[model samples]
Target: MKLFSLKKTFFLIIVLLGLTATSFAISNDALRQQLKLFSETLSYINANYIEVPDQKELIYGAIQGMLSSLDPHSAFMKPETYQDFQTDTRGEFGGLGIQIAVRDRVLTIIAPIEDTPAYEAGLKAGDRIIRVEGETTEGMSVMDAIKVLRGEPGTDVTITIWREGLNVGKDFTITRDIIKVNSVRSKRYGDIGYIRISNFNENTSRELRNELDKLEKKPIQGVVLDLRNNPGGLLSQAIEVASAFIEPGKLIVYTEGRTATRNELSARRFDDKDRDYPMVVLVNQGSASASEIVSGALQDYQRAIVMGTTTFGKASVQTVIPLSDGSGMRLTTAEYFTPKGRAIQDVGIVPDIKVRSGKVVSDESSMDRVSPSAVPEHLMSDSEELDSDNGAPEDDLQLLRALDVLKALNAFGGTYSRN
Candidate 1:
């Protein structure tokens, strides 16, 4: 019986080895064929092109094509472009100060930074850039468009924009400037403390804390956190901002990726002196990424009433992978979800209270169009209007609704009174 068992075990082992060897051989053959095909294509292009293309340029173009095929956000940056990207994260750079993205194969303005050349020039959200410097942007990538728009401070660039209501494109000549973003601003609206976060940069949380400290000194009844037209920034800063309101150890946002395990980002610190007053968060189509993270977490916890239009649906987390060269690639590595496991990709966070600002032109439908009379008195402009230093517009309809919501909560003894 022992001899029979040994013979069976040996036979099984031999069969397993044979299967492994066959699988390895098949994989090796497929890889070799693919590499050969790639090499042949490169050789053909190098030999038959009208002009002999630089080998480095050809290789970089190939890399860019591969990354572009993945997603609109993924791109292979040249060395100088990569340097600019790093400088941008530091909250200062020389550019038109407009966040742009390719949406539906058209270069669309995400948002123009307040007080920047783009904002002052009236570049509105949803404005489609058709041409840059007389050159059509039909097949241009976001990074390419950015490169064309950015130049030395005081240099001018002409951009042709296709607005929603206009039949003919309008040309705007804007001079580039050094964009220095002051992410946080605060003001007191009667008894309510109003804070506006323009972007979530490295110093965002610190600036917010300082502003809050100043506001807390007064008899603040409620708080209004404005996040309109904030094309997001650092993920760490988002967590820190959310932690200011939420209790420690509460899950703020979580991320899932192909290679990495699902990771939860929880609030690690809490302010004991922080006011537990009723809160209202203002958001719009231009509030994205880290902005969505903050709003979604607060809404999920019922800690704040999110007021205004739906947010910009950009919940993917991008990781900048530096290449062996000085260049880097911004790759969408993971998708972010709120604490309740709700994905905000493409489908943005629906506001608890829907309030239209009348300043932005919605890309969703023509029905979203507001009459010129409905717009705020300060916002009556053919061009995009810039937010004030306090971040809230004068006579803004959305701000009025948010204040009303906060007042109702305050009147109800700090309880949320949702109708």
Candidate 2:
């Protein structure tokens, strides 16, 4: 933080900002008066306060308050938090490994990264984290929630969450670990390929390219590109990953804001791999940002049948600005659009085939009689992992639905038509 005269600190800061009411066309004198009022308020507080307040904290608090008023996504990060933010994009962190957002002033889980403590604990998307380590998260900022959830690896933090089916909130104890993600994982189901993209990190596009290449060698009939629970990362990776399926010279995703220029990005690579086969892109509420870009592009071109629930719909682009004090602030700069010029801000991409996730228990199975949420935390347990092969088989209804659609497309010679 740069030094400012104590009495005229707010006044000088405002003048340095040179902010004007552009839309309203308020005069320079009016703006100065507003700045003067701010300085006066601060001066009054400082002169008559019970104790000498830390001037640095006062400035930082002011910045945070201003950012918070802008939007849920924009936030002022302290130096340590800014450092952690940089580490997260590189795909490794000492944290709980969950993507979160603030919705309606409540802390909500976007998705838990695969193979992490949160995922292993069975924390699902749309789960409202009411408390973290007994601290109420009712109005906590996403950055603050992150600070609490992340710490030295091997430390434990218990969170209380409320889900749809549960009558009351449930507590889940999760141990923080070094979250190192291998973004792309694949399984071969006959002539069809099932690829689960857990999260899009620095290496997502490279990982995906290698996986697609390996699968193309076998010449699969169709492919299931799963983006369910993938809280997206790196816009560059989104474009690169989408390039694998979308044709070169075709628009993948674009962004525009009031002040920012419209960034029109298109696919660049096509010859290295053959991608004419039928595809089923699986998405859910957990699918956000980069995941939206991929699925939206594929759907817009009619290249794939999108299945599962609607996406998380985080279309706004945040530009992280580093401050002089090693701190930083993420400011919302733009809103992204799909190839078909669809604005996906609050309204997410809708799937062609809507399939909710659940297992179809046969009538003969005695366990079919059990209720979904018998107890608060009865939804899932360590022994009853939802995605694990070792646990009691949980049929992926969405995957099955996508496969059925894929087979239909295959039978019709890799072509699909919507009625």
Measured on C-alpha atoms, candidate 2 has an lDDT of: 0.83
Backbone atom clashes (below 3 Å) for every candidate: 0, 0
Clashing pairs in 1: none
Q: Which parts of model 1 have CA positions greater than 4 angstroms off?
A: 1-35, 359-394, 417-419
Q: Return the lDDT, model 2, position 307.
A: 89
lDDT of each: 0.83, 0.83
Worst 10 residues of 2 by lDDT: 378-387
Q: List the residue pairs that clash in candidate 2.
A: none
lDDT of 1 by residue, 1-419 (tens): 64455445445534644575567675676665765576567656655767755666866887898888988888889998887778777888899988888878889887888899999999987789999989999978877888889999999999999999999999999999999999999987666789999898889989999999998887787889999999898999999999999988999999999988999999977566655888999999888889999999999998999999898788887789888789989898999999999999888889988988864333656567778788655334311321322444445878867766665565546576444
Q: Write the per-residue lDDT of candidate 2 for residues 341-400, one digit (tens) a residue.
A: 998877889999888898766666655565657633522332243234322324777886
Error of 1 at 378 (Å): 31
Candidate 2 wrong stretches, greater than 4 Å: 1-5, 8-33, 364-394
Query: Global lDDT for candidate 1?
Result: 0.83
